[model samples]
Target: MSAPIQLRPDETFLLNVGPQHPATHGVLRVKMQMDGEYIVKAETVLGYVHRMHEKMGENRTYAQYLPNLSRLDYLGALGYTHGHVLAIERAAGIEVPERAEYIRAITVELNRVASHLFWFGAFVMDLGGFSPLMYAIQDREHILDMLEAVTGARLTYCYYRFGGLYNDVDDDFIEAAKRFIPRMRKSLKKYDALVSGNIIFQKRLEGIAPVSAEMCRKYGATGPVARGSGINFDVRKNEPYSVYPEFDFDVPVYHECDSLARYKVRMDEMEQSLRIIEQGLEKLPDGPIMVEKKPKTIKLPVGDYYQAVETARGSFGIRIVSDGDKNAYRLKLRSPTYSNMHLFDEACEGMLIMDALAFMGSLDLVIPEIDR
Candidate 1:
């Protein structure tokens, strides 16, 4: 009889990728099960920086809670502020002024562009590119300048009031945006040439982390993540609110369901956003920036209401349960990143650690947004 064939035992190792790792973008700990460099399993352990913003909001009055919105997604403060104010206005049955709505829309779209620009730079940087970050920042600075002129703050602007905006966009702000839009479009072409066609970037991202449309819906993915998987479910399109119904723009979708698909979706979204901004500028009407009947204190009708807005990362929903009081009985925030991150557990299985970082970066997570 031949000697028994020697068998090699399967080996497994454990690795902790972050809490401080550069790839995480924020404080996130990913427990990884690895067979060599390939990750067989990955479990993201959050709550590292959780602030419980919802609880804080519930305890504060509507006017007092306005600042908390900026804390949720500091990177996209305007979008967060807009979501909260819009929800409160809807719940209280308040009528926001027409000019105020236009200003809110413009600021939110500009913030969306800034958020996407940062994501574009960071995503490429995670994949081993650097120059795009600098180029993207150059455009983002123009947005910052415009926001600062009206909001008086750069990163965390608390400019959205319950029934309208805190201030108006002056002629200078409009002119700056008009000048910046053409420059941004030109810069986008440069970005397309820089990383979109680079052989190295394509090799790393083209077919990696493919998530099907069914999986995306099941996992509650939104924004570019869902759009990347051929799911056309944008809040702006599906449930139009504010002045989005007046804007002419396409919801960019990709059937590829891979990293490249996500990249393309964001690129296309930037262009669509620019179109929205241009339309908003042209049709912008002149009126009072604040409601004529501004309330001294906000008190909503006793009921529950939800308002959702399309942020740069995904769709953000603010649910307010009012008890006919100045303070909300319950304030629940359904953050897009919270649901989007759920896909990571399934998507990261069997992918290399490096690829996993690329995949996570593609999701464009904001830790506070998830934790809140």
Candidate 2:
């Protein structure tokens, strides 16, 4: 439980921000104690979008529940699904093809780029800049097309199976991805000119609601929130999973620990994601995208298993306890947004409500990811 926020007896008034506010971007609420326009402290209220995802995982067979991962963080569904797939693979000792690992790396990085692009638009819009959304969505469409070509879904994809992908990427899919990288680079340069250096944007976010690295650690913050605070930790680098270890990329870090710093981390991260995709396409080997002669029945060994993957928001972990059944006996999802969002009650105290909202946007939360 979070420490209770001290409230002055008569000076502070309670204010509720959203189970419907546009700035929140989802069904979430925060109870705030305010001294006029300044906030004394906050308490995060959840469960508005909860859908019993963990319970659903427990009720369904491994293959039947695969689709659930995509719904957790739809913008970064590939990353979420990757964790679940890897956890099962580890527990069952199923061998994924070399080509499958390469493809997973490519698709997940593409999804990361798409996720960051959407966040860039929404975040700038939160601070009252609207034009970036137009530019970002335009670039994001290219990736959606590339992924949809093979994955067959634009948003909530169930393209990854237990051992490998649901299907292999054709030459046309590879060509489309290759073409997108340079176009995306050009688009990013356009974004920098239009939003990154704007005086209004910088002033609005520059020193507002700064979260120190200690606060980030205390809250178990990850992804851009932690990276903006100068913690050089990325699951791709620090933990090394999938073909991520085989690729060359840099993790962006900023010491400002403010909204602008978080913005910069994600912006730079998109570029790094492009690097991963480029390397993946170049080194992609010619082999199967699924394992040969897989088991007919997908019963996991009777034990506890876990896998963690870095998503667009942060580190997403899947834990499952199997009783050697086709379905998990118990399942737990550790979503980064849940931890990152909790930091708001501590980090945003004393700031103006608008500034606090700005910091919340910087965390790049997907509320379903939290509510699940």
Candidate 3:
């Protein structure tokens, strides 16, 4: 009798990436299915740093909850705080004073610039470049200094009030932002040379993680991710809340739809934010920084309101359901990164492990934002 033919079964491997890995940029664990070095499937396991922020928000009063927003995206604390305060004001129909709106606009733009700068640095570092991170952080420190003088804190700034800001911007803060603008413009040129034009960066990201416009819409991606895919849907442009209508700036878009395209979009956004800051400084009007008629306590009518603001990461939505009480009955935060990370499942398939990390980094997942 002829011997039976033997065949080898295909091998599947399990890979655990993170909770301590640098590519994660935060505490994220990705369990990947691999056929050799290429990933066949990827699953992201979050909640390593869950703080139960939404549940906590329901228990705290509107003013008391402002401090918690910053903890979501600590790198862009002002943006989170701005969105939360705007939500409360919108829910209660509070009229923020003109000077207060301008100040909020200026400071939020500055915070956006700072946030993008950090992303620029970290994105490059993820691709095996390190020097840009240091340079970017050095420039970002200037914005931090200006923010600290006004907000009294560096990272988690609880500066926004219900009807206005906690305080008005002093001349010193305005002068510092003005001085920082031109210097920042010049520094962009240096960053362009340092990372943007580098052949290595281009090769690593050129065609990796391509997401079509249709896919972005299906998944509700925002900020640079949607823009990179040629979806011109920035909340700042579409919704135009909080003095954004008064400013003239373009929402940067890229048709490339790859990691490289996402990188360029964010780099361009920093320049556009700088322009907004400059215009805000010139057009800022003098008026009361806070509404004189604001009640000592806040009680919204019994209804639900959804407020969305363009954060450095993407669109941050705050939904509050009030039972005519000082504290919200229910509060929900729709974090951008949580939705954006959903794309990683599709984007990382069939890519190498390193390429998957690059794709993940490009998504800019702030673990806290997702877990919040």
Candidate 4:
């Protein structure tokens, strides 16, 4: 999916990075206008993995389109499905069970932690540190195993239903979750000592690619990218979806606005996610996972319905225009990666290629989600 490099007048020469590079993490190609290792300008070229998920949403019924949510961001598929289901549920005026909401919150937070773990490993690997990736993955595997047992898929989960989840959790799932808390806490300490405290790692990221609050506002950036700039806005705290308002958790923010600042934000967020999961698990009520009242068919009234959820990457929103039918008249998926990636062109300008890559890795992009 690599594209041929194009020349620009401002550059001495062009360097094509990725569309196949491991540092890119996916099929992302950056056309860099470079002058002797310094990047004068940069442009991100996407569409390599565009699946047209929005088009698919128009063709399929609400129920039939449920599985496609996973294809957007496989690492945080449950969040996408959660947004889609909530959008439809609101449009149809359906009430979700309390226990089901708790389970949804628990699973989503677990998935968010898994995503941050994966990002931590890959980001370190980008900076030429490989050993930490192994440690990160080792901890991430436990989360994957726990999620797989309930969702029936390790990644790209479609376990959520319109009214509730497709299934319920057992004592084993709860026990595994409780066990992971302390174990992951120990791993976080190790990661801090091993990677976060490393002199070379700190030097590479500390002051590199500092994005200002104004830049984030211009690009409509959210999640850690915005929080790193001290914006102090989280969809969970700002919008309060699902049962997030009931739990006690902190939204991590850093005013430094550099790659290290962004890194710290995600690192702190993983711990907060653990706190949320622990709270949800302790207060998990005993009740039916699914609502008893059922509509014979899923249909949305003619109106514009939008629901947003805070995914691992950022705010993921599903907007639907219904015509009083089972299928959507129009569908729009507002993905966080798209907004986050928008800041890259300006952010990467005038930086060295290596630092630019570090900044890119800090964004934690899932290209398919942006392309979709």
- TM-scores for every predicted model: 0.97, 0.97, 0.96, 0.97
Write candidate 4's Cα lDDT for 22-63 as tens digits. 988899999988977778789999999999899999999999
Residue runs of model 3 more than 4 Å from their true location after superposition? 1-9
Best-matching candidate per lDDT: 4
In candidate 2, list every pair of residues with a backbone clash.
Answer: none
Lowest summed lDDT across 10 adjacent residues in model 3 is found at 1-10
lDDT, residue 205, model 1? 90
Candidate 1: give the clashing pairs.
none
lDDT of 3 by residue, 198-265 (tens): 99998899988888988888889999999999989899989989999999999999999999999999
Model 2 stretches astray by more than 4 angstroms: 1-8
lDDT string, candidate 2, 1-372, tens digits: 133545565988999999899889898999998987778879989999999999999999999998999999989999999999999998999999999999999999999999999999999999898889988999999899889899999999999888888999999999999999999999999999999889999899897778899998998999999999999989989888898888888999999988899999999999999999999999999999888876667999899998989999999999999999889999999999999999999887777888888888988989999999
All candidates in order of lDDT, best leading: 4, 2, 3, 1
lDDT of each: 0.89, 0.91, 0.90, 0.92
Off-target runs (Cα >4 Å) in candidate 1 are 1-10
After TM-score superposition, the amount by which residue 282's alpha carbon in candidate 3 deviates from its true location, in angstroms, is 0.5
Displacement of the residue 187 alpha carbon in candidate 2, Å: 0.9
